[model samples]
Every structure is written in structure tokens, then in C-alpha cells.
Target chain A: MWQEPRYQKETVRENPVEEVKKITFRPATDIYEMPDGFKLLLEMPSVDRETLKVYIKDNQLHIEGEKKKDVSDGKFLLQEIRDVAYERVFELGDDIDADSISARYEQGILEITLKKKEKEPVKEIKIQ
Target chain B: MYRPFPPFGSEFMKEFQQFREQLNELLKNVASGDVHLASDVMYPAVDVIEQDQQYVYVVELPGVKKEDVKLMVKDNSLVLEGERKEPEMGQDVQKIRGEIAYGKFQRTLPLPENADLDKIRAEYKNGVLLVHIDKKEETKPRLIDVQVQ
Candidate 1:
């Protein structure tokens, strides 16, 4: 006897909990290829150094940052800038060495460098 | 191979859709802005506020150096000039996507009579510039005393 599923055999259930994000924005980025490997530049204004994070996992690079709005109480005669979060990710290939990656954030621009691995020796073939 | 980064996750895609809607709103309000069709996205997004004692200006200039920015008052107007130099991209480098605006730009805004341009002060931090200007006492709206002769 099949227990507990005779009438609900094809029923599908989705996760009941999902957190709604308050605000979200995508930061602009520029990718460049260097002699050694690659360079990436991202613009994320007002994000604190401590709030920024960059890490690689499963050969994918992820960059995330958050900017908190000022809590000062004042009448906003003109409102334009607002606090928001930024996220960007990229896939890495084996040609680049992930262990040698380095990054720096300054003036709201994050720069990341990924060094490439040494090329393997080539074997010559002679045609008869 | 160089390629524009795709939406890495569903969260990114959802955010991108919302951002696109907001951009469309901006596009619809073309009359309020000097938006050039050729160059829609520009640098140094600014906000101006008028307070009782002063006027405030906030500008966003990411990746720009302080020395590169120039602020001045000319003909009773506030003038801002700056240049964002492009990072050297070698021949082997291929462009994936470019959204940030670069190169020199100039913006001039007319000031009100109450603005004391000479008393302006500016501070730059976290790639944002905040400018404060004291209000001119003479131009402040006030009631004059009247006496009977």
C-alpha cells in the first residue's frame, strides 16, 4: 500500500518563505585583459570599505556591497541619492590562476586582478 | 573571449527589470533634464537643496580624484568642471560592457539672489562631494518696518 500520497501524487510545493529586498541597484563594471591575466573595475559610490566583499567559489567570482543612508533627521527639500545594495558576479576559467587574485577599493571603484597560469610546452611535429 | 556579464542569478534579473522601469521613468521626463539622446548616462549625478540658512549641493563622482575637479562661480552661476580619465586598456584587452561615463564634463547652474557664492565650502569623501553655501542676508525675504509721518 502506498502511504500518504494516493491523491497527491503529482502535487508540487514551493518554498513558503522568501525575504523581500528593500532596495537593489546594479553597479557598472568594466573588464579588461592584462598581459598577465585580467583586470576588473566596478563603480559603487558611498559603499564603505568594510561593507564590500569579494570572493570566489565554484570558479565563479562574486562581488557584493551595501551603502547605508544617513539616519539624520531633516526635511528633505530635494531627495535624489538613496541607500542601495550592489551585486555582480563573473565565471572564471582555468587559464587564470584564482589563487593569485588581488583586489583594491578606492574612490568608489573596485579593481580586481586575476593572474594567468604559465603556458605549457609545445611539441613540434615535422611533416614528411 | 570577452562578453557582457549576464544576470548571474534570478535576484539580479529581478533587480535589472526594476532598474529598467526606473530608467524608463527618467526617459519619460526628458523635459526636466538636459538629456542628450547621444549620451544618456552621464557622470556626477547631483542634487540641490535650499535650506533656511544655506544651499546644499551633493554630487557623486566615483573614481575621480579631487585635483581633477574644479568648482567656481562665474556670472552669478555655479560652474563645475571635471575629467575622469580612462584606465589604460591594453591591446589584448577587450571591452565587455561600459556604463560609467568618462572624459571631461562641464556643468553650470544659475544661483538665486540669496546665494552667497563667495562663502561656498566643499568637502569630498567616499567619492561624493558636498558643497555648502551661506545665504546672503540682504536678499533674504524680510518685512520692512513702516512708520506714519
Candidate 2:
């Protein structure tokens, strides 16, 4: 004998909500390969240290921040700069040591350094 | 066909009008040419905002030092000049990629009629320069009460 479990098939509905879309721009970057590591420089104007975020996830480097407008209430005589967030990402090579990465932010420029991992030496096997 | 030229409508007047139009076209081309030349150098982004008491000018100059920038007010125009030097790296370092613009930049913005040039103040922070110019006292809006008869 087989018994069927009683259950109610209720449809789940999601409420519609309005969302604000934010504009994002990619900051200009310069990459250099140093003797022992790699250095990356990003130019992100008006982005302060407190708002900037730099991290590595899944072997990819991510940098993002928002440029806040200090004066919000004003009539624009000439508007050229836009209120937007800056984001950029780069893929990391396997030779890079993720644990030894370091960064510094100054003068609206972010500098990140990624060190290379130590290579394993080759073992010479003697004739048996 | 040649007839006696009327004093009011003559060929000289038509020639003058044509000359004026040509002069206007030439001036427009020259103005646009100047903008094209300016673009050859670095043109930093700028924003001018007007407030009740003052006008603010914001200029973005990243990777530039404060000492390298110069601001001056001359002939009812604000002149901004700066240079962005490339960072020095080690001799063994190799460039993988470069996208940043580095060079001398000059930008001039005309001041508004109501701006008080003498009261201009500037500040620089985080590679952004802010210039505040107070508005003329008499030019500001004022509320006047009308006397009832």
C-alpha cells in the first residue's frame, strides 16, 4: 500500500519595488612589472580613503569607490563632472602571491603591489 | 543689366553684408580652432556651481601635487595651469600597460559679471581643487517692501 502526503501548492509572489540605478566609470590604470613584484596605479579623483575598497577574490583583483559630491544643493552654471562610482578589476596570474598584496592611497591615486610567489627548485636524481 | 543704382539699396551694401558674414564665419572657425588646439594638451574636467552667496569652481587633477598647480585671475578670467609628472619606477621595472594621461594642462574660465574677483578663495584636497568666488553684494537678490497708499 502507498500513501500520498497531503500538501498545498501555494504560489509565491514578489512585491514590485523601484530601484535607483547608479552610474559607474572605470578609472584609468597603469600597470608595471617590477623586479620582485607587480605594481598597479589607478587614478580616481575625488575618492577618499574611507570610501575606497580594494580586495582580491577568486584570484581577481577588485577596486571600487564612490566619488561623493560635497555640495549637493546648487545651480549648475557649467556641469561636466558627474556623480558616479569608480570600479576596475584585473585578473591575477598564478605566479602572483595573493597573501603578500599591499596597497596605498594618496593624492587621489591608488597603488597596489602584488608580489610573485617563490619557485620550487628542481631536484637532480642520481642514476640508480 | 545695369540701371542707375539707388542710394538706399546699392551693390556696396550687398558687398558689405557679404563681408560681414564672411568675417563672422572666420571668427567662428578661429574660436573652434582654439578649442581644438587646447585639446592637444590635457583638459581636466571642471564643474561650476552657483550658490546664493558665491560661485564654486571644481577642478579635478589626479596624480598631481599641490605645488605643481598654479591658479591666477587675469582679465576677468580664472586661469588654471598644472603639470602631472609620471611616477618614477625602478630601472628593472617594465611597463605592462598605461592609460593615464600625464602632461601640462591649462584651462581658462571666464568670470561672471556678478562675481567678486577680490573675494576669491581656493582650496585643494585629494587632487581636487575648489575655487569659491563671492557674489557682489549689490547684485544679490533683495526683498523690497512696497508702501501701501
Candidate 3:
């Protein structure tokens, strides 16, 4: 049976200490099941390699990054992109090999490959 | 004595402020006929900034290649067209969940009359595109000294 990845919702604090609160947005993601394993792609614009982090803990995969603002001194005439952090979590199944997971980030896209564990072969039984 | 609700600097107030700003932007876009509510094509978010000498347009286009993008100047508008192709997968691949938008996108922005289209320059880096349009020489703010009578 194939298990779908679950998303974990984060709770916002009722009272924040900082004057300027940093918002976190969930990046768009795509999950695909391959012959050998699973592939995940996340769109995180303005996120660089230095600010991106991909890790696994307790059978859950976490992808988080902070978008760096390049030009801060200019006055915005039309502002659409918000300065926020990107975060998303997905639960991994038992069929995946946690240790064999690999990730790469390029052009603001993070690609992750999770290998599936090898299954046991069945033995043929002969009856007299 | 009257007190402000959400206590001025509270988290809820800050979030409300952010929401208001976003709503204002959305309303502005709608008024300017820039919002496309019925279109299936993805319109990359943009931020236009005004500087001393030039106007900058920053576009967010994650997962798009530079070769697939096309930029042009038509009349008094800057047109941006690009395609974000889906990532290549194996023949037996099965999509479990897809939230990313992948396809051709087009966004046209009306340029100010003072913008010097001849001096336009663009650069793509880290999935972000930066377009700088220099201001015309005569239109730029100039300092003048008055003769003392």
C-alpha cells in the first residue's frame, strides 16, 4: 500500500516578542513515486544554498530556508513578494531508506531522492 | 481611558498589519487590471522598486531555466514570457502530490514615460530575474543653484 505524505501544521505564537515578526510560508512541492524510490521537488525562490536546510528526523523530512533580500534600500513601487521563511514537512514511510536520501538545490529548486528498501524474494514450495 | 485592541505591538496586530498591506497590494493590482483571476497560466510575482537612477523589477521564477525565458519591450510596456517545464521523470513514475505550477507564464508591466527603454538591462540569478530601467537624463531630478540678487 502506498502512503501519502502528511503535512504538519505550525502554530503561530499569540504574543510575539520581536517588533517585526517574520512570517513563514509553505513552498510549493511535488512528490513522485519512481521505480526505485521517491522524488520530491520544492520551489523556493530567492533561497540560496547557504540558507537552505534539508534534514530527516523521526521518519519525517523537513525542508526549510530563508529568502535573502538583495536590494533593501530601494522604495517599492509594487510589492508582491513577501519577505518570509519557507518551511514544509513530510512524513516518510517504512519502505523508504532513510540513510540513502540525497538532496540538491539549484536555481531555487530543491530535489530530493529517497531510495526504497529491497524486498525479500519468495521461495517456491513443491507438494508430493 | 481608551486602549487599542490587540495592544499595538502584539503578534496579532503585526499579523493584521501584514495582512492589510497584502490586501492593499492586491486591491491596487486589481484596480490596475493586473490581476488575472480566470487565467490558468502562472504569473510570477514581481516587486518593482524605485531607486535614484533606475527602476528595478524583481521577478520570482523558481525552477525555470534562463534559456526558456524571453524578455522584450513593446511600445511602453515590458513583457516577460517564460516556461517552467516539468522535471523529467522515469516512464513508470507516478505522481502522488503536485502543488507546483508548471507551464508557460506571461506578465506585461506598463512602463513609466520617463523610463529610458534604451538603457534597460536584465540579469537572472538563483531563479530570480532583475530588470533595471534607467531614467531618462532630462527626467531625472537635478539640483539647481539660484543666483543671489
TM-score (0 to 1) of chain B for each candidate: 0.61, 0.66, 0.66
In candidate 1, what are the lDDT values of residues B1-149, reduced to their tens digit? 99877767998889989999988866753322212233434557776777778888777788889999999999998899988887777587876556567888777767778898779999987778788888888745778889879
TM-score of 3: 0.76
* Model 3: per-residue Cα lDDT over B1-149, one tens digit each: 98677655679888999999999977764433233233346779999999988999999998999999999999799999989998888699999877677899999998988899999999988789999999988845778999989
Model 2 docking category: acceptable
Output the lDDT of residue A19, model 2. Answer: 36
lDDT of 3 by residue, A1-128 (tens): 23325432332222143345555666777789988998988878888467689888888888877778867778998999877677677778888898998998878888999999988788879997
TM-score of 1: 0.66
Local lDDT at A92 for model 3: 84
lDDT tens digits, residue span B1-149, model 2: 98976676677799889999987866654432211122225678899999999999999887899999999998999999989988999699998777677889999999999999899999888778999999998845788999989
How high is the CA lDDT of each candidate model?
0.70, 0.78, 0.80
What is the docking quality class of candidate 3? Answer: acceptable
Q: Which candidate gets the maximum TM-score versus the true structure?
A: 3
Ordered from best to worst DockQ, the candidate numbers read 3, 2, 1
A1-128, model 1: which lDDT tens digit per residue? 00111122122223123233434445667677667788888878778677689988777788877764422343555566754566656677778787988998888788898888988889788998
Model 1, C-alpha of A53: deviation from truth (Å):
0.8
